[model samples]
Target: MCSGPEADFARSCVSSITSSGQRATLLTADGVRIEAARTPRTPPPAGPAGAPADDLVIVLAHGFTGALERPALRRAAAAFAQRAAVITFSFRGHGCSGGRSTVGDREVEDLAAAVRWARSLGHRRVATVGFSMGGSVVLRHAALYGQGEREGRTGAHADIVVSISAPARWYYRGTASMRRLHWVVTRPTGRLVSRLGLRTRIHDRDWDPVPLSPTDAVPLIAPTPLLVVHGDRDPYFPLDHPRMLMAAADPATTELWIEPGFGHAENAAGPELLGRIGEWVAARG
Candidate 1:
C-alpha cells in the first residue's frame, strides 16, 4: 500500500508526534535554515510505475507561530503519510527554522525550498498542505510556481493545494476572537513577545499589512486545479471563505469541498474526508 514495505516506506513524515526523531533535522536553503521531516511514499500498487508514491510529496506548513514539530502538523502529516510522501517543515522563524517569519511573503519562499527538496527525491507529484496561516502559504506557492507546461507529467510543476480551515482574507475574514488575537499580534503585546525572545516561535514583530491577500492570489492559479476544503463549523474561517475561493478559481478546474462539522486543523479527518482527498489526488494523477 505504501511506497516501500512496512513503515520504512516513509523515512520521516513530519506527521509523527515524536518530534525528537532524527527526521526533524533542519536543512539550509538560500541562506535560511528550515526544519523539514521527510516522509517516504509510493504509488498505489495496481497503478503503473512513477505513480504518486504511497509517500505523497506532501509539504506540511504549520499554522501561525506553529513550528515544524507542532502537534497538529505532525498528526496531519501522519494522516497523509498513510498514502503519500510527506514533508513537514517549520517556516522561517517558526520552530527550529531560521529567519524571521514575515507573515506569508518569506514563508512562500520557504515553501518553495521544501518543494524543491521533495522534487529532488524523485517525487512524481507534490502538494502544499497547510493550515490557517500555513494554508495561506500553500495558496501563494500554487499561484506562483503552478505556471508553465508539463513535459509529459514528468516535468510538470506541483500545484496541488489543500488548506484546512483557512481564511481567504486575514484582514476581513478576521473573526471576533481571531481579530482580537491579531490585535495583540500587531500591537505592543507582539513587541513584548519579541522583546522576551519569543519572536522565533510566532508573529512577534509587526509588519506592514499587505493587500495581496488570498483573494488577490487566488486568480493567479487559473490553469492549476485547486482543492479548497474547509469545515463549515470552522469558527475562524466561515463557509463564505471557501465560497470566495471557488468563485475566484477557474471554475472549469478548481473544486471546493466543505466538511459539514469539522473544526480547525487539530480536528481529525477520518476515512470519509481523507478518502475524498485521496480520490481527488488520484483523479488528478
Candidate 2:
C-alpha cells in the first residue's frame, strides 16, 4: 500500500509498464480512430520441461473520464497482465482517441474494435472487462455480437465478459455523482468544463437511436459467459442496477458478485480484486 508522492511514483512506474505494450491504432466501423495497447503476458516460472503457456487476452474498457494513461487503468492492466495478455484503450473522446463521447452509446464500437484487434493478434481466447461507462459498453457489445454470432459491423464477439460498476439504465441521476455526470454530458457549460478539466469531448446531442440498456442487453448475452460485479455501496448506481442486470440475464450463463465495501469503478478496484478478476478470466480460458 503506497501513499503520497511515493504512490504517485509507483503509479507512474506501473503506467510505464502498461505503456510499454505494443501500441496500435484501430478504426471503428464508424471510422473513429481508437488508440489501443496490447501488453504481452509475462512468462511464468519454468514448471515442467516444456509445458505450453496459456494464450489468453483480456481487453480492458475504462469508465467515463478515463484513458489509457490514467494510473488506475494502468494498474488494472498490469494486474491482468500477470495471468494473460492485456489490452487497454481509450474510448474515443478520451486520451489520444478521436471523436466525441456519446457516453456508452457509440462506445460499443470502441470496445468491439479493441476486441477485434486482440483476436487479430493470434490470441486463442479473448475476454472483455469494463469499468463504469465501459461496463455498459461491454454488456451492449456482447448483446450485439456474442456467442459466435457476428454482426455485419462488428465482426468478432468476446469469449467472456465482465462488467464492473455499470449502470442498468441510461439517464439515471439517482446519486450525486451521476447527477453531476448528467450535467457534464447535457449542458454546454458542463461540456466546456469537461473539455478543459476532464479532457473529454462529450457529444452535443443525445443518443440518436438510443442504444440498448445494460439490462436490455443482458438477455442477449447467452451461451457467452457473463459476470456482473458491482459494489454494494456504489454511489452512482445502487445494488438494484446489478440485480436488474442479473435478473435479466440467463442464470445458467451469468454470475453475480455484489462486493461489500467496494466503492466504484477502476479507482475503487484494488490490486487484490483485479488479481481475482484476472484469475476468473484465466479460468474461463
Best by TM-score: 2
Q: Locate the minimum summed-lDDT window of 10 residues in model 1.
A: 1-10
Residue lDDT tens for model 1, 30-103: 56667677855433557555554443466777777676656666666666665676887778766656566676
Candidate 2 regions exceeding 4 Å error are: 1-19, 45-53, 147-155
TM-score of each: 0.77, 0.89
CA-lDDT, candidates in order: 0.65, 0.85
Superposition error at 285 for model 1 (Å):
3.2
**What are the candidates' C-alpha RMSDs?**
7.9, 6.2
Instruction: List model 2 lDDT by residue over 131-158, tens digit each.
Output: 9999999999988887436436544688
lDDT of 2: 0.85
Q: Give candidate 1 misplaced runs (Cα > 4 Å).
A: 1-30, 42-56, 148-157, 191-211, 267-272
